[model samples]
Target chain A: MEATLGIEGGATKTTWVVLDAEGRVQATGRIGPGNVSLLREEELRALLAAIRTETGGQFHSIGAAFAGCHLAAQRERIAGLLRVFWPSAKRVVVAEDAHSAFAGAFGSGEGIVVIAGTGSNVRGYREGRWARAGGWGHILGDPGSAYDLAHIALQRVYDAFDATEGLVPLGESFLERTGQKDLEELFVYIHSDPSKDRIAALAPCVLESAAAGDRFAVDVVLSRCGLLADQVKCVAEKLRFDRPKVALVGGLFEHSEAYALLFEEQVRSRLAVSTVFVSRVPGAVGAARLADEAAEEHPGVEPKPSRILLRESATSLDGALTEERNPRSRFLDRKSVPELVELFLAEERLVEEALRERKEEIAAADRKSSYAVFCLKKK
Target chain B: MEATLGIEGGATKTTWVVLDAEGRVQATGRIGPGNVSLLREEELRALLAAIRTETGGQFHSIGAAFAGCHLAAQRERIAGLLRVFWPSAKRVVVAEDAHSAFAGAFGSGEGIVVIAGTGSNVRGYREGRWARAGGWGHILGDPGSAYDLAHIALQRVYDAFDATEGLVPLGESFLERTGQKDLEELFVYIHSDPSKDRIAALAPCVLESAAAGDRFAVDVVLSRCGLLADQVKCVAEKLRFDRPKVALVGGLFEHSEAYALLFEEQVRSRLAVSTVFVSRVPGAVGAARLADEAAEEHPGVEPKPSRILLRESATSLDGALTEERNPRSRFLDRKSVPELVELFLAEERLVEEALRERKEEIAAADRKSSYAVFCLKKK
Candidate 1:
């Protein structure tokens, strides 16, 4: 019997599932962030090979969604690597993980999926169209995300401190959670080696504080949720979703039932959002479905241009020039060829910095890959 | 004529003025941050020797205000270094640089000084008593500071981005100012090696954007100034100064005439402020006056306990374990002897981290000190 494999890579961990032709889960495997953008070509190859070994079976179809796989060129490159890893696979597809998230949220149905986990993004599908808001990242976007909640809360604490309202309950809770003795140590704990997931890890404290009537924390969460509601509204308006069904997916919503309810109330008030539900479908399952669809498609259809979606872990792209589009994408439409080339060159300069920042993760992955790759190649 | 020297050390640089007994400036010299807390014992001694060499003359009195000299023990340690540098000086005193700023702002008179530079503080004096608000540092306090302005502006930009308000004029200006091409690059520009002064440097962009009529930027500055106004009132109420004089000191006020005007408008509307003026008296000059006063004081009059004032650059204290008092100070009066010792030991672990961070500055000073100390010894 023919089978299909689907992979979903994230900042914290990478997971994949194998499905028999009948669409039943045949096997599952997990590993570190075998991510798209940060890995060198060889490392990526090693990761894919290891995945195949874990499945311990041949596949005729594959769909892989990795963070940092933004452009058609990137997707095609990943597809080529998969072909080499699983030579028997006749159909292969690779896309940015956001697609998998959307697939996970609503499958083939039309609705908006708000992914506000380690990073954040909002993507909607309706009538064969996709619209999105706030998938940019923590730096200039992703407001109302877990990172935003924690960051704004810190700002409020600092601002409150100026009014001689020093170290309110919210700030004190953060100090306790992080095992930070004082504000100075907390600052070091954050800025010294800031990570998106790591900072977002502190969001639960803000939620806990707000739940317990910490005024500042409440304000922080409410304001962020308001922004997030606006984000949903933007996608709703853009996609013209009449009474849109929304899936509030991420660690944040899962961490606190009160937080999820608060966010739902906000979005419901701001947007006539019809349905709000925490996502139950795993992104890897959506990838498997996508794999199934790809295998069944007629060979004549030109591969559709993958729509832009946010990576699972935007922090993986920190210091990384996250080039979403190549010269062909809409982002480069206004630029002259030379200007576009120059833009790419400027991004190239920052690539090494990103690689260096991710060196530890790469080294750790390399250690795991060595044994895994050797075993897979022998098979 | 008897001679006296005054030294004021900030995060960016240190300056000293040798004053004649009549309070005329005889000579002035400047160098890099001869900070207190970050410096090791030998490094502090070396820095003092360098200052003495630059003075090129013997002094009867010396008074120094250095960032990080918070505790009585730290002040005494600095005084001992100064004594070694100026062996013939009859009187030596040391204090935190905030005192120098307060002395600079009001001299011997009683008034409130609002310092909203890279970091911030509000200190008011009345009848030999001092009251302070908001000198805590950027992590927990120092709102209305330059760093706060820049940071808050960025947060607004991020929140706005969720609603498709990405890279507003204020954020664009920050990118232009930092020479970053995009938001992700700007994040790297900030978090890669976050520093208080470095982040504070972005404040002018927000100020400029506000001047240019960017609504968010305008709100950021206005709100921050309003906070600064409240801070002034806190100090004023605490010290019970009737229609007290307020000095708007620091780079924020110095950077823009309109900003200072806006701040004054807020404070005047909130409090029955008698006078608000930009400070012209440099902290070094205030330190010079303090030196002269020390030289003239009777031997029986104990050197007064140094009052807490905000540092000239609070960034120097970032990531540092800033201990403000030893067992003797009023701060520790309520604590048991055992608790005080335990607290000091807890701080010892952080001391090494601070030292590691300041190693480059120490090395830079050591090179300069070797030549300077040799010349001074020969004299």
Candidate 2:
């Protein structure tokens, strides 16, 4: 039985599935995360090796979908890994996890995929055209992102600080999670961190509270869900996705059934979404399906990531941290040039610290490169 | 014939008034910007010199309130300049324009003063204590600020780009003001700018559109006014004020009667405000009035800005531009470390460019400092 291996990669969880040449389910497989950027090459290879060991089978072709695998270099790196494990395989396909999720929902068709994990994004496809909304980021506007909810919750806590001595339920959750006694320490803890994952990780805390019937938490969750739904509707409207077959992916949809229900309610209420599914099929299966199609079209000739069926991102995804609102410089628009300089100088410390933390790695690489140069000179 | 020189310095405009020993209106004086951060000492002196020529009289004291004049060092610098001009003055008082604005509105009494200039801030005083809301900054939450209005408009334009070919009224205003043909150029131009004044400068455009009944513009302005109004109410409730006397200040109130009315309406509808008035008397007059009270209490002794009637800010006011949301890094929370480093590196270019633009002045300062060291050594 000729089999095609398929994998769906995401930040929250990753899964794999296999399909026969006739597109029937073949074998179940297990793998680690599919988000390419989150793993080192060695780590990814080790995790991926589990599938080969578990199935003990040769694949005719392998299709892998991983989150953040957008750049050609990233796709090539992932493809190289696939080739290494399945050296005898005639064809391998590597693509974005979003594309795979879309395929999983509506195979070889068009629809919208909205993922509200730690972050949030909405992508719609119709008639070979793509329309995107949200995903600008937490600062610019993540809309329904976990970071966004956390920000509002934090802001609310700070606001309530002057109004009352007691902590609100949301604030209490933050304090309990952070193991801090007071709001001041909580404020410092949150502001001191360089990454948002710590803040975003509290989304479940908020959701759990909401599910437990906290008015504020419930309101925040519902409103945030609406904001996310608005993105889906906006994307659908742009792509003219009438009766859109929408696939909800990522943390918010999977972690809390209540949250998923609320989000679905928000979406169904706002937009005429048809076949709104929680995407039980992992992206790996979708990727395998896509791979099967690609193998049929190319007849075993090697195809670059660009040749994959799903649309390549046309928008500038150079998307960076510089676009983020620095919490320290929130009032910058009100500052004069001299004050602006002072603020910029303070921000420089953080950037320098970011580099300083990577000093040993940078130094080690420099030494290796220098020794390489010495060897070349000796040669 | 003893007199006091009072000046109110603001970003929008600076005004000055004179009062006699008996607190009656005296010979008026003319001066330039009262924003201490915006002017060099020489520039300020030259501008303050206008008052000297215009009034041509000595004074018993001088009370000048300048915007952004908060630091102890900043107050001392301004006081030094005042001493040079008012040689024999028994009293000199330098204060924040907000303090003066509050004083101007209620004299020695208590009330809330809300300023919605290029930036927005609300400060309320009751008894001996003070309460404040908003004015965190554009990124943090300036509430009803021009920057807030402008951000919404720009976001609207970007959202509309995928939906329609025609420019919305707000977009039209942005393009017309920037002298750009389409949204692409406008987007590029905005993203390229180092400062936010370019974006904030478009507030009037949004306001004008709102005034002319542009649906999006009207909804945005009204909603923003409500946000700002909420701040005023928050401050009032914190202090437990009944029939609070609220005074509206800043460019939004002064530039557009339509906007001022809308804001007042929002405030009135939300809270039981006994009175709401646009502050016609500039902050400088209020500073002078406070100076008069100080002279009476201390018997002609010079009081530091700290000793003045208004409460010193208890919160961390070491505000900076780093707190701002960098437009380029809008999606940073979603990025990985490698991508984050890339974003940070790109942001460094902007900071480097900022320093490069001032390189000539920096070099000159370095040369001067080196020469000073050489001269000291020779001595």
Candidate 3:
């Protein structure tokens, strides 16, 4: 029988599920990562082949939401790959994992979704106008991600070690958990590894310390959560949703109740949000829903793939001169040398006019300046 | 026949002055720039030769204060070069221009001196102890320098051009003074000529606009002056000088009464300074005074050159581990695996003991957590 297939692919793993027209789950499978941006063309083909083997039954429609598919180019590449794999399928849809998460949380409605797992990002939607803020990768700006939380905890450990007083108990516990002999060894380990997920794995220790009344740990978590809340608020304002519903997605908020509660409280205190809740549906299920909705909306017609290229060439002065709209200099190229001289004289006259208009103000400033008067008298 | 020679060598020009033992100026000469850091070894030798020719009869002593002589190594290099140039001179002194400026203003007493010219730096002297702040070169720090001021003004012009509201009068003045057709052409000009002094030349326009009541210009100058004040305050605190005397040096302060007045007001308002005045004594004259003082103090013996090496090797993880004083990890290398396991177990036991000590606090935190209880109940 005809069925719709949904795939949720990330950096670590891929989940695939098949559902019949009535939304009944017919089959399910799991495999390694299929994030198109991280995979080579051959590796991506291998992943698609593996996925095709699992969801091999007759499929009328398919939707694949993959991690690292934030850019339109990435989404189009994934869609093109799916088209090659399942050419006979009536419709194939590809989107960023955020789109599936948004659909899963609010079902194509107006809201904001914040993902704070290994990395953090915020997406807001209002009547088809989508806006995003604070997804600047791990090195620059992930404020409330697990990696951020763990990194801040490690920084505190170093701070405590360098303080005039000895290490605090919270810092001592971080040392114990990591099997590190001291802060020096911890620095060595951090320098050697520098892996985002490996660093993120230490966030649990920070939460535990905060639960045990470590003031430093609590402050770290609270401040990071505040930053996350600010990201949501910024997206909400950009989308101009007065009281948008916000959904917190990702393992950090889903598994850690203490962190989730703190994050929710911080977000609500800062933003006039309508509702804030943890998303229960997985991204795979959201993909299936989007597929079903796309099939119903298009009714046998396939959607066009994204053609907009996002990346632009680096800026140069010549390019800037040609591109920038400057009304004052617009007629310079058409003018003769004598005309240019006249224009230059006119511009010089404008400066004189501006200065003349401000003569009284300048005189007033001179009169009020006791020091200037004193210096002039000395001269 | 016995005359002391003093030279103030900087990025723009070098000033050489010959003074008698009674502090009367006997001769004065000016030459090209001789900043040791900016010059080749041959170029520096030539500049020294030119100065020696100007003060040919120098017999008692010589002092040279050169720009870019901040480090002890630079000072020693300058002193060695002086010894070669005037071998029979009774004493040869070399110092950073800041030192001579400080001596000029305070007469070898305790005080703080701020030099705000093409670049900015702060020097503090307290009971023979010297301290410094901010002067981390142009790319890193120099926040209150004329280069910094002009650079920020240019940045604001671009910002206004990109902004929807369009350019302010301050930005207009900047564009006019630069003689650029538009912001795009200005960008081209800036990229073509990245000279620090050329960029610093635009600072007068900023000050002029600020005096003419441009709010943006006023803010920029105020903020930069505030940064200069902070540098002074930081140096003063580091040297532990209460109500320190302050000397403002450099051509920026000497030439611009408005900027100098505002800077003094901002500094005094922020710091409990005893006195603030511009140094009327040129750096070359201060160098002459230092030469005379050195001859009197040493009588016949020449001072040994600076021995301090400025550069250190880059930090490595292995170096850090070996250098850090951690008593607990000192004996780990001698322990076997079984002994290490035993040590690990002991550390684990310490964690348990520490947790046991805070058991009541942890229990109280758990009991008081209304959100945690809800989460646990939901689970």
Candidate 4:
């Protein structure tokens, strides 16, 4: 009667499934978004409580894959949250949405996974080493996402409104679909809402326009596909794989055969990947499979009690904020010589404190270290 | 008795020259950094006073080109500052540093100017139209600048420290030049100082290593030069030039002949340019030439009095701060149906007020419009 629980949590929705020892589905439930960064603590707790109510019975193991679980700290936080609801579960595994997608596509194997749903990211995993590129969200990169495709179409619309040339059929269709009377209203709608999903919704117009032979739209599609292919090539090079195996996931490829074919053709032309497959398996199933493996590895072992405690300090994610706030050393340029000297002294004191904290480790290493080893290390 | 004055002000230094009606140099003065954005009012006033002391003579016309004179408002502010120092001058012309560089290289003609001093920017001027790219400052862009080159070299050094592979000769050179024994000391030095100029000073090591045929260094140089060439191409495309005329400026080009040649080769390979020149003419001389042209055109006509007053209001720069402070519209996501409706109504009120302000202009345009024009416009 021992079973496993699996969950796939994303920006739009969350899905949970319970499976028996033989992998037969026992129960299933669907709920709202479960992205921890996007949800309040109370909302997350309530969602988990509802899931607990629906599942009804205890499980041998539980696994969850979530969006916004890219950082190690995020994974740890989600693991802590899960342990509260499933205290008796023998094993709990938490991972990024991409990792689950990859596992679902190719179980325990080496491959590249590209997810081009609302956003796009290309990740390659081979023999426990991973390489990734072009997942910098909407503002920074995201070259081949629905949002990117729609953004290109909108840029053309704006251009057509401003200039005499470069008009496309998609501009008219977009206006009609949105009930925007003119470019000015379209501008207002775009600026006022500023939502990624709302923007991505316009991607269909681009595809339709391209299918109907709009040159501008066709160019956008081709160029964006080329850019995605470049991302694949970049990942392959970084991973140094002899022949990459790639799996494509997400809504864009599933819905549009034309886009999928175009993307595949471009990628094949650029990279010598051995295989590329489009997977329809839900990431939740992959989570369940992973739980089964973990359970079999550590059979009948009790879960650790200390796993429930959350790590308090904010980690390396805050490094980006620090860099942003102080981009350059221009502040030092304005300070007088004396002030700069004082600042340097203060910084040196911090270094001294850090050294003091590591004094024991340093002394132990010094006692054990040899001159030959030090020279070898230097070389 | 009538002399024309010209000044070229940059991030590193400022140069001023006094010339007679026949373009003979009367007096010249050089001083420290003159970027108005980087200087306080009192500092700028003192610098101007020092310049006045050096060139102690009346001038009929004065033209000043300054860094940070990107916006029309910035130009106006610089002009106001100039008027305070030279009240009796017939005319005071203030422009961006790039414009002066262009004028210096190609007087009143169409050409692209690429500057790679402390920062990097590509500017194309054709007739009265101007197009620019890649001057997003140190944090965002500035891809081919000295700071950018140094930053790339520093990243490689850190990478080598962390991993066994990817070590290059430039890392040792950089460590030696910075007087840092290890990565920890380098980290402290970089964090404590944080100055663009200090970082940029390391660029010479990259160039030297590149010249010495270090594979990693060569790759960095080639890639960066290619990026700069891309910027040049982008500006040319935006300006829609048939055969671009280009001039290279800035300290990097002046000091590094090998780098200049490599950059030129890359740009020429990618773009069909009619002419490419590396000019040694100072920007101040260009400003002087511009003043000479202005004085000839206006003769003894007095400058407009209203031009002395600086614009007081801070405009769209505040918009960026607002966007950063409230990145998401999740505030709207949390509101109930009635609250959301109230928010929408409030937003509509603001829109209505904007429409009210522009009502007269809209009506004026409406009277001169036709159905055919409207449909054509819509199409």
Candidate 5:
């Protein structure tokens, strides 16, 4: 029996759907954090197995879109994994989740898409060329994103407490939310590996309060939306798009209408020509479409362009590029592709280290590990 | 602003009640398995803290009744702990949980009471004298207890799979429950510490099938009940109360009426008991009542009894004593109590060894270090 599998890897959740030839989902499986930047390859494979179990078997072809998986190297790594998991399959396709969100939002057309969950990013496409905005680490950017909103709200709450010299009612509320005793503890918690994302998720609750006329919280939300608009503006200006069509695709948009509307108002107010639209089709469906496109483009490649067996040559080229600095080339081109790739690879390592630290903090959490997982803040 | 605290410690749960001096419970706390045979004194303190957190605070004049708290040395150790927790309180009482159950069942009167949860035991009282039957360690006894039923079920399931000389349906079912591929994997998991308790819990689910009259499961339950009845018979025969009043307590009574009726009928058929009663008052309450009695019996004693505290001590002691040679003679025997107490001083080296082993396990638990006052079990 022929099957099509679509996987959507998010900062907080990895969702996958198995469809029969007719494109109707037979089963769906959901788990947390599948981005290789955040999860080990073995962890990703376990998630795939969970999907397979939910689907009842292996599929004929698969399409997977991942957050923080834009690099060509990651695509090849995933392709190899798919081959092992689906040896008899016809094809496999792997790509950046932005592409999936873009397709889901605008199909084959040119447009920009914004996604915000534990992390946030904006991507623009024009005739197969890609440009991007925001999604810098939590320390630098991600305004209007869940992480951005949460970060801002936490600061404001702390600021208010500090302003009152710790006499503020909100200090107790924050303590209740994080289960920490004071600012020092909260700092340790935030910087600790696997930082709590759910604490940041409370940004929406704060946003809701602001919408209900809580001036302090509303200011936090407004500032967050303004920052997100500025990020989108930066991408549009760089790409030289007169009136780039904007599409929103993420939990930040799908779950919160207030945040979406506020973001749209801010972006349109800043840029005259752009029109933002939220995507109706999910990212997984977009991945499925991309898989179909890849198969169409490369029809007769050995093992098929879209199919991969996970067991074949279990290692990949990424293993070779470790810390043996290309000293000669480091002096050659400062902004070369190799340099960019190395930076991402280094970032992946940093992210892994951070996640490990987060895991330790959460491992000590009694009975509710999921809550710790939910609480993790993605940069 | 003053309060009265009551505690009852049994095989299954150590319960604590804080009342506002009017005998109305202000807060209630429950902890499982207060048997000193299983928990070290330090482990007991942690359990007490858990109950204290649940109960909200310290209270005046606490009463505690503990299981397996027979020896004078054990009582003195418990007395010291109560004094520390309730120093400002007017009174503290400590006694055996059986007496409290007796009071709750047939207050201030003679009767027989059977208790079962993780372990099973029967206690009979006639004119202030008490006798106990069963409640040995899981390896030695504990028939009609959840632990015994669970143990038997596990063995049957294992034996059934082995008899097939390969994989059986039961093996497949067990694999499904544990998400394991086969018996070999299951066996490895069964040996894992946390895994044992999780698998044992599944046994009760199997008992539900037996209650519905699955022949194999029925036999398991009946055999367990028979063992329980035998324990009760030992105490009843010794007390020589022909037509003695009997009361039932614990999880077995609460969960399965059929099992309880069968046990009652078997006891009646064998021992010619006139009245069989089920106690609605919890064992913790009974323990508290006994604690009250103890403090009153010995006034100006610094330590006051706490229902939840002593049980925690008992559990900690049990975990500590697992590897130690029987020191029953050191603590038992009233005539030699002074000599034995002096020997304890002489054998301070042995006590030190036990404390080290306990510290190792606590360290291995790898969480926050806990505080405890007594050391009974070692590595």
Candidate 6:
């Protein structure tokens, strides 16, 4: 019996399932916080070991969907890790979450898949090419994301309170909730840590309260939905797929009635998109199918790892460290200017400048001093 | 019978309840993210109405924990809002969360409270006076917060991955979770959003994986714990709190099993006169009680707010908004010389000279400019 494997990895959790060739889930194991970037080799190995032990059955092939696993080096390292454990398994493949999400949404053909979870991103697949929009994290990007909508609402409400504008029920509710004696405390709280996404998560409750007839809460919700619609417009523009069958995947779209209604209404009103998919499909399922495709095409060919290997790979999947340059690990190695810039920027001086606007002035001054003589006379 | 209210309001969520004065939670209702700074007046009024509906009983006197209520202006606004709602409530008072947490811990006495939730702050209170350490945002501070821990882990793992150091399991796991494909992808993800607290939340998982023998994860966790301990020690040293019982509050310390243990062990090992108290007392309870204390002590006294209402507060919360100030708003406000210097220093032009490595060359250029000015004056 060929053992089957299923993997569900997300920002919050990672789950793996072993299935027989017939597709019955034979064994399943779960691990905490499975984003590989956040895990160490020992932890990864331990998690992998847990799965390997639970499944026991040696599988003929392995398919994995990694959260944030779009890089080639990451795929190679993951493949090497799987190769160690399933030595007999001829094929191991990894692909972007978007690919898997696309597959899960349309199965085989072309369509647009929008993922809105803790973060947000939209991917369009046409003519075997993929174009992505948004998902730029909760900061600079993530336009129509839950975090974005919630952040905008919160900011507007806060602005109203600061202005001492007329009474808003949600603002009053906010005062009651924070238990802050006044505006000063609220500002401090907002200034403190400031998780816009976490704040955004509470958006659903606001919408619910509004639908139940709280004018203030409703206003906030409407404002939030409008902001989300604006973000969707940006993505639609980028992908150039107007009126495409858009599948909505994320807790916000799935749960919030007010937001969903408002979002759909706004999209129809604002953009000339043909179809809006309200279908629920997991990104993980999409990721799994993408892996299956990669495996079929590549067969036994595992790309060389670029420069980084997972901790899990060290112990179970990839096995012993090679003092010499291992052919398999080479694919994980590549250098980029931006990557180098990031390193240089890590120095305290650069980090300080990045953190504070004024610090850049100081850095510029120091630069001028060093180059003053050089400018006067060629170096 | 007087109504009793249970309110839990922070930067994240808000809750309000009413019970008889005998202290039984009666009716309960929750509204969406209610930070006053983020709400409009309409939203505030609507949300407050919902709370009133949930109570179903008249609140003779109510209590709440509010976020960013530390400012005098904010306090007056909240008082005004509350007055509008429960007109005949015998009394109302507001105070800071530090005071609330202190009261919750000692109930009117003095102790140390270390909070490590979305942000990290340590406050030492003794006989009404308070001292604080490290509650800056992810941009500046939050040394021991979950965000801080996660940020440090990301940095370390990335450094290790890039370095020629022997690969570890934690490194591998990190790669698996991030799916960076390679260094370039990893760089992009790190630069995206790059929240310190979200990163800190991932520490526990690293700790868990490390304990199971993920060496890389273990190293990261140990280093993070060390940083946290250092933060506690820095505050302890600054304010000579001899054998003070440091009450640990916040999700990071409360939820992470080994993290608390490791933190406590590290602190004890380093400080000769320090005791760590893992308390169950919630900050909200403390905040409510603090409000009661403030009400009792102040009697009928209420602050007369400055004239600078919301219209004049159009800039960022850090007091950058000067464009909207009217004569009335600017009436009593005066900037100190030091404050002016600080503001001036914030200008991008002034700080550039200091950025260069050769300060003397810049100084020479300045001297030449001064000489030219002299010559111009002579002419």
Docking class of 5: incorrect
DockQ of each two-chain model:
0.15, 0.04, 0.01, 0.02, 0.01, 0.06
Mark the regions of model 5 whose C-alpha exceeds 4 Å error after superposition: A1-3, A19-27, A50-61, A88-91, A166-194, A295-379, B1-379
Give one digit per residue, the lDDT tens place, for model 5 in A1-379. 7777778887767877665665544555567787656678789898877776666556666778887664466678877777777666666778777767665566556666777766677777665466666554342245677766766566556434432435234434556667877754554455342243655656666656554555566567778778677767766765677888777766676555556556666677778544455553545656655564453422222111111211111111111111121243233234432233233223444435543545533233222322221222110
Error of 1 at B124 (Å): 2.7
lDDT of each: 0.64, 0.63, 0.63, 0.63, 0.56, 0.50
On lDDT, the candidate that comes out on top is: 1
Tens-place lDDT per residue, model 1, A108-202, is 66788888776678888888677778665665467778887887787677656545646788878889999988775675566544666677788
Model 4 alpha-carbon miss at residue A306, Å: 21
Query: For model 6, how does the per-residue alpha-carbon lDDT over A1-379 read when each residue is reduced to its tens digit?
Result: 4554656566677666554453333445566666665567787677667767776646665667666665676667767776677677655666555455555556554556666666666666655555565454564355556665555555556445323434366655555666755544554665564765455555554656554656566565555455445555554555566466555656665555344554555555677755554433333333334444452535223211211111111111110111122232232224232232222212324433333543343234323322432222231
Per-residue lDDT of A97 in model 2? 67
Tens digits of lDDT, candidate 2, B1-379 = 4687787777656667666665545544444455666677788888778777776657877777777664566777777877777777777787777777677666666778898877888888887667877654453466678888887767676666544635787888888988987765564466445244777888888888876767777777878888889888888988899988787776687566557656766787788976665554445557776566554332223332223322211000101111222343235435543343233323444545544554454335323433432332233
Candidate 1 clashing pairs?
none
In model 2 chain A, which range of ten residues has the least summed lDDT?
A312-321
Question: How much DockQ does model 6 earn?
Answer: 0.06
Predicted candidate 3 versus true structure: per-residue lDDT over B1-379, tens digit per residue: 5677878888888887776664555667778997766788889989988777767744677878877665555667777878787888877777767766665555556678888888888888777577776554453356678988887777555534433336677767767988976554555466445577778888998887765656677778878888888778778877888999787777677656556656766787777876565554556766655665553433222222211100000000001111121243345335543343234223444535544554454334312333322332232
DockQ of 5: 0.01
Listed per model, the TM-scores of chain A against the true chain A are 0.75, 0.68, 0.75, 0.74, 0.68, 0.66
Better candidate by TM-score, 2 or 6? 2
- Once fitted onto the true fold, the runs of candidate 6 whose alpha carbons sit more than 4 angstroms away are A1-3, A19-29, A165-167, A173-192, A213-242, A270-274, A295-379, B1-379
Model 2, docking class: incorrect
Q: Tell me the alpha-carbon RMSD of every candidate.
A: 19.1, 22.5, 28.3, 25.0, 24.2, 24.2
